[model samples]
Target: MTREEIYSEVVQILADSFELDAASIKLDSTLYEDLDLDSIDAVDIFVQLRDLTGRRPDPEVAKQIRTVDELVTFVENEIAAAERGDPEPQPQMPPGAGT
Candidate 1:
């Protein structure tokens, strides 16, 4: 998806998930200050992003993700890196478990 498409989807997710105003969620809107997103809200956004993009962004990435544009970039990078097998897989296992 294009960056604009991702941004729009993210904005819609924020509005639908958090009851935020569609007009208020801008590309450069500060999540904490502008949207007043608290801890739980941030978690909700992460979950939604996970469901939508099939990737869980790191909390550090979330901390640095101050705006919608940054979030779009983050998701894009995560998807790309996942395709390239760069980031470590979740749920570290001891060799083969179901063998």
Candidate 2:
């Protein structure tokens, strides 16, 4: 998916998952400060992102994501990396199936 599409999906995830106002989300919005996300919320987002992109993000890299823009860029890079076969995409499992 394109960057714009990815941004839209991210916005939707935030709105749907956290009940935030979509209009309030901006590229510079800080996930914890502006969006009021906690660590658990961040994990939820990562799970949704994995489901969307079919790739898991490096935990260390995921920690550095602070804003919506950074999250989008990370996802874009993950998609590109998958396409390049640097790390093969993993099979997706249904949500809650393993947990």
Candidate 3:
């Protein structure tokens, strides 16, 4: 999907997950500070993105993500890379599977 489409979906996911107004989530909005999202919320966002994009973003890369725009861009790149077979499938345990 295009970046704009990915961004729109990301906004919807955030709004639905947090019950925040979609208008309140700007591209530059900091997920933690502006959105009041804790670490667990971040994980939930990642999980939702995984479901939406069918790709798992690297946790290391995710640590550097600070804004909604960044997340959208990351997903855009991930989806494109996955389509091109640039990303090897990584093992994933379902949430709480290891704990």
Candidate 4:
């Protein structure tokens, strides 16, 4: 998906999930400071993002995201990487990965 499309979809997700005005969800809007999203709201948003992108976002990378634009950029990069046949990197694990 294009970055524009990803941005639009993210806006819709945030708006619907938080019952906010889509018009107010600009690129610079900070999820917590601007939108008043708490940890639970953030989890909901990330769940929706995974559904939309078909990839689980790296939690470590996600921590660096503070604004709507950063979220969009992360998703866009994941999509682009998938399109290029590169799997999004998964979190490292020791032996007995699921144990």
Candidate 5:
């Protein structure tokens, strides 16, 4: 998907999941500060993004994502990478998995 399409999907996810005002979300809007999203909200967004892109983002890189533009770019890159047959980094196992 194109960047603009990814951006629109992100906006829709925020609005639908968090009851945010779609118009209030901007490319430069910081997810934590401007959107009032806490850590749980960030996780929720990651889940939605995973569903949308069929690839989970690297957690370390995800931590550095701060703005709507950054998220859109990430999703766009993930889609492109998938199209190129690039192997995605696997999500780490949770603590105590297979214990």
Candidate 6:
């Protein structure tokens, strides 16, 4: 899937899993600070992410992905890598995903 699609999916997942307003979710919305997500919330989100798409984001790296933009970018890159048949997990990019 493309980056735009990934971003859309991320928004849906976060909104549903976190019980937040989907319309309020933005690129720079911090996952923890803005959404009040904890470790269990993170796990639920990741599990939903995996269920929706085959790719899994590393929990450790994901913790550092503070904003929606970073989360979207990371999932986009990881999905692309998975489609390319990369067997191993990719290295974690710093939060904000170069934005």
Predicted candidate 3 versus true structure: per-residue lDDT over 1-99, tens digit per residue: 778889999999999989999999999999999999999999888898887667877888888999988888889888887788786457766877764
lDDT tens digits, residue span 1-99, model 6: 778888899999888777899999988888888888887887777777775457756667777777889878778767776789766555578877774
Off by over 4 Å in 1: 92-99
**Per-residue lDDT for 1-99 in model 4, tens only?**
778999999999998889999999999999899999987787778788887677877778877788999999988887876677776657677878885
lDDT score, candidate 3? 0.87
Instruction: Flag the better candidate by TM-score, 3 or 5.
Output: 5
Per-candidate TM-scores read 0.81, 0.86, 0.86, 0.82, 0.87, 0.77
Location of the lowest summed lDDT over 10 successive residues in candidate 2: 85-94
lDDT to native, each model: 0.78, 0.90, 0.87, 0.85, 0.88, 0.78
lDDT of 4 at 10: 94
Tens digit per residue, CA lDDT, model 5, 1-99: 767888999999999998899999999999999999999999889988987778867788888899999999888888887778888786579877765
Displacement of residue 67 (Cα, Å) in model 5 is: 0.3
- What TM-score would you give candidate 4 relative to the actual structure? 0.82
Candidate 3 TM-score versus the reference: 0.86
- Model 1, residue 20: distance off in Å is 1.3
CA lDDT of 92 in candidate 2? Answer: 73
Please say which candidate is ahead in lDDT: 3 or 4: 3
Clashing pairs in 5: none
Per TM-score, the best of the predicted structures is 5
Give the per-residue lDDT digits (tens) of candidate 2, residues 29-71.
Answer: 9999999999999999999998667787788889999999999
Question: In every candidate, how many clashes are there?
Answer: 0, 0, 0, 0, 0, 0
